[model samples]
Target chain A: MSNFTIPVGPLHVALEEPMYFRIDVHGETVNNVTITAGHVHRGVEYLITKRNVFQNVVLTERICSLCSNSHPQAYSMAIEQIAGIRIPARAEYLRAIADEIKRVASHLFNVGVLAHLVGFESLFMHVMEVRERMQDVKESIFGNRMDIGANTIGGVRYDIDPERIGYLREQLAALVPEVDEIIEIYRTDSSILRRTRGIGVLSYDDAIDCGVVGPVARAAGIEYDVRVKAPYAAYDRLDVPVHVLKDGDVWSRAMIRLMEARTAIDLIHQCLDGLPDGPTVAMDERPAIPPGEAIAKCEAPRGELIYYVRMTDSPKPERVKWRVPSFLNWDALGIMLRQAKVSDIAIIVNSIDPCISCTER
Target chain B: MLDTTTIPLAVLLFPGGLFALAFGLALKGLDRRVAARLQGRVGPPLAQPFFDLVKLARKRTMVPDIAAEPVFLGTPLIGAVSMLLAAALVPIPGVYAPNPLLGDLLVLLYLLAVPAVVLMIAGSASGSPFGAIGFSREMALMLAYEGPLVLVVAAVALRVGSFSLSDIVAYQQTHGAFLFDPVMWPALLAFLAFYPANLGIVPFDIPEAETEVLEGPLLEYSGPALGLFKMMSALKAVVVLGLGVALFLPLAPDGPAGLAVHLAKLVVLMLVGVTLLRVSMGRMRIDQAFAFFLKWPLALSVLSLAIVALA
Candidate 1:
């Protein structure tokens, strides 16, 4: 029973993302977890501070591939708050629509990852095939599949017209049946249930103690979702429902993601029904950065993503400190997988939706 | 002596081991092309196997530091050799097998398992977590499919009244093929279960589950080692289908129709199977596949045996 280190990252086998975790194994059981990242680190924190607010719109999207929009939207909202500007009502609704669409695509991607991890390639392929529609919407509307540069300082830069909105509606319409099929698959696929049900159990209170946010928090029966608790953008204007499960195991987290994606789809249609006609950006030209410190929080695909800005009447911010969701969720990896079999680690790690790039940045 | 030598040489080169390899390669190519077409993409050419073999042979071998290197190195060659031997034992067109009894329907179970056991041992010796998990699951799946497959093969042997491949063919020639028999309809049902078990597709592929286990038993196999594994998989796929076809249609020893005609039938059988299996279905979960095989196909195989016994 000699202690041996099994590296699970950077270029190690099993990890799909760019982060690494070396677990100390005694025979077949993991006794300790040591994580290492920075492989995809681009020093975005420093880059964002130097760049003008307009250029950083594209810059912040690189924070996380899955939650690409939320980073920019939250950053934009922070900038607008610092200048004490009121964004156009229409702009807020559009931001909400964009965020919700991104949520659906992101959640589906994670669910597909889980399916793929469980060796259910049919469900994986189907989820991926269905996800192409979301990609289409993002490309046609935002001009890229992963990085959709939607947010401006005061509001959104582009607007979706009736024709494009109708197209978006059509894609969501087509995805509904398949989404229903996927939900049933996850529900009844007994092996998936068997492996995931009680495998990565974390009590409700333990999650809150770890400062986990979003779905991870909600799965543990904590009534704390950034979207629901502190409503921002169109979230403030409308009633947003949340899905909560008492079991904080890997499967419960997955169930929460699936339910939330459905909610996101519904939220987008609601935004479309209530979308007002007007200019996307405010009339403020040559908007200057005022002296202040502002903290912006948005429910990213993984969890609560927070960005802090400290401006001293200069265009450049004095400091840019942000907390990536993976930093928090991945810490709980040791807790979840300590005594579990070596085989369960991959799927359990996937349930956290680790954004290694964001964590490294 | 000259006449005997020429006949033996012709048999060796004509349609025995070489035919099995070519036929298996063609079926694999068809499976890939058909699967791609179903997924809406153009696939690789028919001669892709030649390129693959060349590439694999040229690549450097890296045996894992912790592995039983000799065994890991040896199993692939052994699997390939064993598969070739299995093919040689079957009655190939224009060839005389040394012993056709290995292809006897009742005793077919253990003979068919030689390649898989070699693979499992290779994976187990690799000394990686994925390999361990993969090999463990493979053993389980092996046990799962074995029961029904044995029963089905026994049913065929009962219908034919002899254990040798040549005798089974003679019976088929005398009594007509089992495809005509009502009892074999249930055996045809068993063929459905045999398909996944043979290829070890998604649901049955618990050993090499790509997403979770990171290619399972194959996690450490690269270069020439991986190549041999791939070749064995493709060849065994054809062997499995050959067993199914022989049980149902039972080849008639070419007769006046010639070697080309016999080979043409095997090729058609492989192509039809590839089309039906590759494009039409997706891999099931392991538990569901196990349940489906045991509950339905096992029952069907037993029923087929009962009907044949009565007949």
Candidate 2:
């Protein structure tokens, strides 16, 4: 009978990232939600400016673990644009392969947490187990499980031999069928539908107005994928299908991730098939930068990751700024959680895949 | 078999206290392991729940400055003890029958509801905002499920023409179990629906929903107090499942085989009805779950009552 404000997070189990929400509720219905960030802020932008171009690749990649490859890849692309360096075709395909693999793993991780938040523990575990295969692929191919460190100044640092390519092919072929089965379960399971179908609806207009990106934007029926729209890296070479849904609810967000994971699997296959036989990295040393201000954007697993670089003749850059997709996706949480039940708050927050480490960094 | 001294022994030792606690914890462990296997992973050991209780016992119980100390500290004890008594009241067909002086089906119903009431009290006493939300949710869930439960009990009592559990079991023994009777099927189905909600498992565990409320009332509890709550829940599981066995299908042979049969039935029920169901479904919001309980189970119980009255 009492209407009170419940403060969730900063240390709550539901939150994977460190953020706080002052949720005002009248009984079961959440009346208002106020979000606060900065818990995981690492001051990486200022730190990145202190480092040289080669070091900045390592620094930017440390920004967020889930989209670690995207940061370095985007930062490298911006420097490539400034330096006018053309990466070899083989390196471009290799970069795309790394990005797509991360995308599948990242999307699976988000969807798996969604299942956890909804209290379907078995589904959460199953989704995570499926994601483990992608993690293995990243480890086997890129030499690391989390921060793969694939991208350098001119191109990708990691190359696939025919055996590794065969390994990657075998992994993807096995993963696709399991991913399809999970997608089918999410699509038709009555309990999942009842919990998520209309839980946190973000209309197409709201999604566009909020400038939501990645799976969150696509879920709102907005055909705005940075891969399809901007065509960065090897995405331009391959036809990356933009997966969209009309509902804009938690269900749509989850479905979008599963669909994108499928697309990512196929994209990886295409990248491997068309992988050119050339040098993986253009230069053995860090390329010399005589750079003006340049901006580069890449579609991260979460959304659009943009890096802005400004450099003079010196090795250390004047300034380096980056905007992560979670920044855009986080604002939409206020809209999504408004008027939602207390039970739906966790799932809705998770549906946005709001990466606090990415946003605060 | 119906002595006053045996009543306390039954309540404190064999059927209730130690026995119920051990069985309940093991059942929970089995549920977790089976669920993990179903999800394709290596689960915790079957002794995991027991280990968790031991771990909880070693921690500190912190009471918030705003909390009512006695009520907050006392509820878990009360909840656990209530289940201990409730466990003895559940007759295991031929092996066990509670003393007539101790309680019967109706008294057992009131005892079964004590844990929810204790949870509500604990939530309210903690004076935390999450606790308040949990308080409201636990109250709502109790209100929603109590009607169908009472109605189901009424139908069974009316069919047997006695308020005592022993009479109901005896009637079923003489004239075959109600589980096989076409007319009592609705009541049986309603009882099936009621136990999961009563046990506070998924789809109906909206009150202590871990993600939303952070285990609600038990959030502020730690150390042995939290362990007591865990023990309370474990015993409550046995009591509720045992009640379902007693009310619907108490047809085991007399002696040690009867006790084995009863325990096996409890394990099967816990695995199939609780573990599998929890794994498959998502938690329902309070309103949705409330509406569900009031709609189908209420209707089914009412129908069973009407059918029993006519036939």
Candidate 3:
């Protein structure tokens, strides 16, 4: 019953990435927590300056697999802004399609891991099976599952033809019922609710104070989503409904992700319906780069992903930096873990959907 | 009264040692396979648990520098041995009945408690903080669940007017199994809850939740030492499930048919009670599980005991 300190990972089953937590506990209850990061840090920010503007698009996508599309998309958006390039209307809708596809996959993956951490392996497997349809669509459309390589300086790298669009529509139609079933289970299952509801609570005030974003912030009742607020790519042309909840607990976070994933499918369909006729790029030839600086932000699956690009006269950029949503969300764990049961540490950490590669990179 | 010559066969060959070990490992394999199928996965083969045991046995044991080596090394042996013996005590109705000299229901109950005790000892002696937390949680859970378990057993014993498991089984065989008897329903339900908690499945596997406490007590265990712990749990599945069958529904044909029926019932109990239940649920916190055992199972068992005594 005496106070003791336990290390919760540099390596552990619950975490997908390595980040250590030194938790001090009085018996089963956590009294304090100290987070030590930089385990998976590859110094990608520094590596970005070494690569040229066009190559860094590929480099940025490698930063985090879950938010892979967002990184390159945001970087390209920044690069396009610096070069004064307006992407073609058709390309804008194509980028949105790719973004929503990744969003559905990423959100489902996070919630699936939540089910896993909850010890509901059956539900976890079921969720993953449903998410597999999105993965298949990515593979069929972009020719790669994780890193879709769907972004370029001026616009998107890939476009959906009528056949591919039909395939996507078919997959999305099949996916809706499975996702709806999972959402219903999360809403009504006593075991999941018992473990998640009111556990690891982050208040609306605390969420704002911690500067949390995306599902974590929205779960805490903050009505903020970058797609709705900033409206990048073709999101301005599409209807993106932001899901919000009041509890700000693990269940709320998972529910927000589920709702958004379902909404992402709708957004993809909307982009397909509003498909326009034009080029998928700004121009046929590669444009010359001038010394300039610009910032671009996009709604990543986790939250708002911001890219800051500074170009010098040289082919290599002077600097490229990003602020991922996980950076702010990691700070909220101290509040969440405070006075939580030792058993809930993993569930609470998973609730924020912390992307160590994104945050540390 | 003791049949000294047949003791070794009882303990080492037919029922306890080799047979129970194989049966236990097989039960574990089936459980895993069935659970995986339930989750829509192509699971490991039925011999997977046995393969793991062989793999573990061939590996070298590594004792931590901070650990008390003797207790840490010895607890798994004790736990495995206790269950091995407990398995022998469970009568297979018309197929086999243990000798009275080999001990009875009360002795089996005490032996049944050994695995949890040694797990506690192993946890504390391992010198890992996670192990220490696991020890405390296991102890708390044991304290919570043990009351209901003992009371449920007591209710059954009072109904039959005997502490002998064979007697209880014989009584059920003639008058009708307690499984179908309305009077024994509360005790049966209490026992149903107790086995899952004792077997360390989801909603009750708090002490060694791999995510939370990193498998807690077993975090520091490695090699053949870890294999023994696995063997212990596998044997426990057989012992606990077999015990449930004997206590409530020991109605089967004589000889080989009875053995077949018993094994079939054990598999069914395992699939429905343990595997299906575990896959479908999330783990509970120790406090929540502690409260749950105290609230429902304890009350039901006490009600059964009171009713049985009066009747």
Candidate 4:
């Protein structure tokens, strides 16, 4: 009943990846939460320097599995900007399709895990089953499931043939209704509402102060999405409606992702319909890199994923630095956990969708 | 009528110890399988709970150095032994009747609470912070649910004019089941709410909310000690569900046919009330769950008591 501290998850089951929290509690209420975030550090920046620009594409994608496509996609975009190369319109659309598909899968996985943390095993299983349709599409088209090897230097690696396009459309149509059903349940279920609503409140002002990205930011009424604001890849050419909610609680964070997944499906359909006819690759010869520095940012499933690439005149060049969305969002956890009951801590932590591996990398 | 000497056999073999253990594990398996099917997956085998028990036994029993070795190791044994005795006190209408010499409905009610108390003691003794959190939640939940349960039992005892479970069964048989009596319906509903919370399933399983506290008191437990806890739960399920059968609806023809009917009723109650409910809803926080029990079930049980008194 007195003041005490509970250390959670350097290797605990509650955490998906290794990270530790020193939670100081007076009785059941959490007084303060101090987090340690270097448990999964792999020294990825040093590893990136060992590989050439061409090989770094594969290496960077391994940074985090959930946001795998965003890493390579951003890295390639940064390199293209530095070298002053223009990708064909067709390749841009292909990259958009891949990114949106990954977004849907990643967001659904986060929501499913929320269900699991709340001890709603059935919903977790059901959501994962719905997300598997996208996984199958990735495997069929891009030839891999998790790391969809879709991004190349100048263009996308795989094209949506007429057969694959038909298959993709069928999968998308099936997925939309299923996702809608799940969203409806999450919105209306009183048990879920009781656990999530008003439980982990990160005010809009605190959100902006912390610079929280993705759904966590959007939930707090921050209307900043890099895809819409900066317009990378095919986003500049297409109309992408950003999803935002006023409440900064766990429920709003979950709802933001669910609504955004629906929009991602719509974006994929538009990308396919607006297919431009041209060579998928801009040139047969690889562009030579000059000494330069460029930064590229993309809207990943979690939030804004930024890559900073600096090139010297060598095969293995200067540095490849990435600032993943989870890095900033993990810092705001202290605000969320302050005064929350011990029982709500897991759901609150999961609400931010903290990617320890992404942050530590 | 069976001789009083067979009470030991009843408690140890036929309807109590081995039989209750097997039936309870099977019910859990069915619950998991049905829940999985509802979610569109091929679930574990019907023998999965038994397999888990076996797996737990094969593992080594670990005693945390910080833990109070006596209380920590002894509570699971105490809990299992209590349920073994309680299962014998439940009379299966025309099939089997417990001897009056072996305690009655009042004793069974007291026995029903031992598992929760054991859990509280076990949690406090484990010396883990999560265990302490679990201990407090377990205590709060117990305070909430126990009041309504006692009132429910009081209502049934008043209706039969005796605290003996066999008399309650006899009264229900001749006068018709309390389940169909509109006056006793409040008690039935109250009891329905009471059992799931007692069983430590979702909506009331905040004490061991796995993601939050990592199985709470049992976090530091492993091997045969953990196996004992599993056995205690399995036996407790049979005692609670069997108690429900005796109190509300104990009407079937004597012999194996009656046993089959009783088993069928337990499976139906477990599948619908526990499994389906667990699948459909997320867990409530401890405070919310505590408030809920006090508001609805408590009021219902008090109403049942007033109805019984008036009749």
lDDT of 3 by residue, A50-144 (tens): 98888898999999999999999999999899899999999999999998899999999999998889888888899999998889999999999
**Candidate 4 ranges beyond 4 A from true positions:** B1-5
Predicted candidate 4 versus true structure: per-residue lDDT over B1-311, tens digit per residue:
34443878998987888998999999999988999899898999999999999999999988999999999999999988999899888887677788888899889989989999999899989999988999999999999999999999999999899999988988888999999999999999999999999999998898998999999988889988998899989888888888898999989888778889999999988998899888888888899989999999999999999999999
User: Which prediction has more favorable TM-score, 1 or 3?
Assistant: 3
TM-score of each: 0.85, 0.98, 0.98, 0.98
Evaluated on CA atoms against the true complex, candidate 3 attains a DockQ of: 0.85
Candidates' RMSD to native: 4.2, 1.4, 1.4, 1.1
Clashes of 3: 0
Where does the lowest 10-residue lDDT sum fall in candidate 1 chain A?
A: A1-10
Native contact fraction per model: 0.23, 0.77, 0.82, 0.85
DockQ of each: 0.25, 0.80, 0.85, 0.83
Query: By DockQ thresholds, what CAPRI class is model 2?
Result: medium
- The alpha-carbon lDDT assigned to residue B159 of candidate 4 equals 88
Report the CAPRI category for model 4: high
Q: Residue by residue across A147-197, what tens digits does model 2's lDDT show?
A: 999999998888888999899999999999999999999999887888999
Ranked by DockQ, the better of candidates 2 and 3 is 3
Candidate 3 residue spans exceeding 4 A from truth: B1-5
